[model samples]
Target: MQEFFAMGGYALYVWSSFGISLLGIVYLYFEARKYHKKQQRLVRYWLHRQSKKKSS
Candidate 1:
């Protein structure tokens, strides 16, 4: 109810901290995915180069 939202008169601090933590988690998730994609691309590129070298 209202009391839950108010959070014992510390709603601003509590909610802001919670929001910041949520944003941080979301940012980390996207960053990790981006890093994973970049690593995959690098691996593919490395394999391609290795094959080229072997063929030569």
Candidate 2:
């Protein structure tokens, strides 16, 4: 197991790369979720305005 992790002394580079990639994936997920929620809110607001206009 130690040898496997060592990666022939390139362990630091290899491990850090994996950590950075994981963080990027997590960041993208949250960003996408936030964007989706914002879009939904905008859509709902527009629909509400249209309904109000129609009623008036």
Candidate 3:
């Protein structure tokens, strides 16, 4: 068990590399969702304006 975490004396490097990669992936996921929501709101607003123009 201890040996598994030790990673043959390279534990710090291995663990930190994994942590950075995980953090990057999670950050990108949330950022993408935020951007998507922003785009959706913009599109909805544009459509609403178009409909109002057509009605008038």
lDDT of 1 by residue, 11-46 (tens): 999999999999999999999999999999999999
- Please give me the total number of clashing residue pairs in predicted model 3: 0
| Steric clash pairs (candidate 3) | none
Root-mean-square deviation (CA) per prediction: 0.7, 0.7, 0.8
- Backbone clash total for model 1 is 0
> What's the residue-level lDDT of 15 in candidate 3?
100
Residue-level lDDT of model 2, residues 1-56, one tens digit each, is 99999999999999999999999999999999999999999999999999999999
Ranking 1 against 2 by TM-score, winner = 1
- Winner of 1 and 3 under TM-score: 1
lDDT of 1: 1.00
Candidate 1, superposed: residue stretches over 4 Å from native? none
Span of 10 residues, lowest total lDDT, candidate 1 = 1-10
Where is model 2 more than 4 Å wrong at Cα?
A: none
lDDT of 3 by residue, 1-56 (tens): 99999999999999999999999999999999999999999999999999999999
